[model samples]
Target: MKQYSFNFSFEVLEEFKKLLPVNRSKKILKKYLLNEYVLSESLNDLQEIISETVIQPYWMTEAEIIKLDRLIKQAKTKGYSINRSAIMRDVMNNLVDRYRNKPIQKSKQHRQTFKVPKGIKERLSLLIEDGELTYELSSFIMDGYVPSNDFPSMRNKDQEDLNFKTDIEVFDKMDEISSEYGFKKGGRAKIFRDALNQFEAWLESDPPKKAALKQELKYILTEYKNVENISIIKEEINKYLKE
Candidate 1:
């Protein structure tokens, strides 16, 4: 069996300690692997780590590598560079996927105790925190968002048109819409925001006619499966109706 080792920063390992289940299982590993942005960020962090680093090691037989070569090919076609780190990451991801087909173990053998690095909170409390941030982080992971490299001085120009009070506020709106539509719960906010990006103009237009607003909203709801494009729309329409 060939052993593969992936390096992680102390900080990134802390993040995994928070995000991963206390009783580590291949199932949870598969979930994170499917999150493109999380995987991307993980790989990026490994490259950026200049201080203390940790090694996460996994072993694989030659047959296992050959069996999962298809996934590596698919990733390459999607523009992911073929590198040692990428190959090892994909192999680990593929094993988790393959494990899904095996019979579930009744003896809890699948769940192993995860050793969190120093400076992290206790496992029990971390799980509680994970409950709150999972949805938010999952939103980023599924969306494949890579952070912009623009300097802090240029941020105002990029966000001058943003209407949301905060990024969390945007995710909160997505959570609500997801519940109504029974769709990508906790993820639709970004998608919808980008879809109806004209909300600023729509809100400040002359007269702000309630009837016209409803007509436009009705169209959005139809296309997006009964979703409210954004919370501000409903609030503004209600205020306009009263006037």
Candidate 2:
């Protein structure tokens, strides 16, 4: 974070009044001038002392202000560099963090879905027959892809099926299934590849059934883990759709 210095004066006060209506302007101006009073000291040390005592006290009073002025004069006898605005802002930020209790909001998690377009599906089916598409690619496709109006439906299905699962779960399940079957490459990649192969076979047998099966696989994968593989799958799906 960077620190910023602002110079506020009577001219600035006039400019501020332009932003307010006639009735509200006077009240605002009065408050602004009163706040500005702490900034009137010439020496840095005096300014700092006045700011810490008067401005940083949470509630300003006449007796406090007088005491702050005395402290400011005392500090001037010594030597220190202090800016009124800096101290005031520091205190204000602290007060806000303590009393205001603002909390940062995190982004909501969403489930994965599938939506195959008529054109993309046709192209994919052609690729499958031609043998240009692999089980890996098909797996990626089954995971999720773009350039289809059916994506919303696929996503909804995925959510309903694998709502609470995280990415690690998917990875673990893939490993477990592959190991049980004595898969040569029993890793996340291989499990995903296996899943894709099964999905593509379903797609080839019944084009109409591909969508439903894809949604099922997506739900299954989600149960295993919240993998970001969907991004890669989506990219491939887009590339295929573009072709």
Candidate 3:
């Protein structure tokens, strides 16, 4: 991911208003400027959209999935019309972004401030004097003190995205692989890619170096007997020696 420089100042607001007809006060422009943009991307390469996608599907057993449907329904019940994939992307991005300074190398992470109240600066000082209040504490103390700025950087924004794919099945498989491996949300594809690279190096090794098997491996080999099922996507992996 890359860092971006955006003009989120009053000039952007004024300039945007110039393009529109029947506009009113600068207050309207200020609200528009402060609005949180929905993170979105096109499934097809030939379209552009907002929180909405150009268009977007699914599978997996009740035992082998992340239950994304439950999340989508929750969002719907709360009045959001976004698709499940986007919801998942947003959730993953938001989680990662929150702890970004401590994130793995090359992660797209950032936060956004959606709604803040008036006199929050004064309120914050009062809380600080009352005890030691932080942005975290203040979040609960006073309801409208948003202390972050959002970026849609985690999701694909354009045709240049390498991770961009139109196939919903790819994301489904990712979810399944994530569940099978006990990986965190949105991390399945990356871990699988790393495993493939490691396996490729093993394939090219002289006599294929034998590493010590940890208990995790022992458990997988003995108890988690789904290795054969997993190898369907890469059958050659099953041909390797276990010892």
CA RMSD per model (angstroms): 22.4, 28.0, 24.8
Pitting candidate 2 against candidate 3, the one with the higher lDDT is 2
lDDT of 1 at 121: 26
State model 1's lDDT.
0.39
185-209: candidate 3 lDDT, tens digit per residue: 5454343333323323322331111
List per-prediction Cα lDDT, in the order shown.
Answer: 0.39, 0.37, 0.31
Better of 1 and 3 by TM-score: 1
* Per-residue lDDT of 183 in model 1: 53
Please report how far candidate 2 places residue 149 from its true position, in Å. Answer: 36
Name the runs in model 2 displaced over 4 angstroms.
1-167, 182-186, 209-243
Candidate 1, after superposition: displacement of residue 11 in Å?
1.5
The best candidate by lDDT is 1
The count of backbone overlaps in candidate 3 is: 5
Once all C-alphas are superposed, what RMSD does model 1 give against the true structure? 22.4
lDDT by residue for model 1 over 1-243, one digit each (tens)? Answer: 544445434454444444433224333553444443123433333234233433443344455455445545655666554444454444344444454456234222121122222222233223223333332233332332222222122223323222222234334444565555555532354444332322222222321233334445655555555444657666766899999
The parts of candidate 1 lying over 4 Å away from their true place are 1-3, 31-53, 59-68, 78-80, 87-243
- Residue-level lDDT of model 2, residues 10-129, one tens digit each, is 233233323333223333323443453343344543343221111101223344345444544555566644443443333333333433343222223223332232344354555343
Task: Give residue 109's lDDT in candidate 1 (0 to 100).
Answer: 17
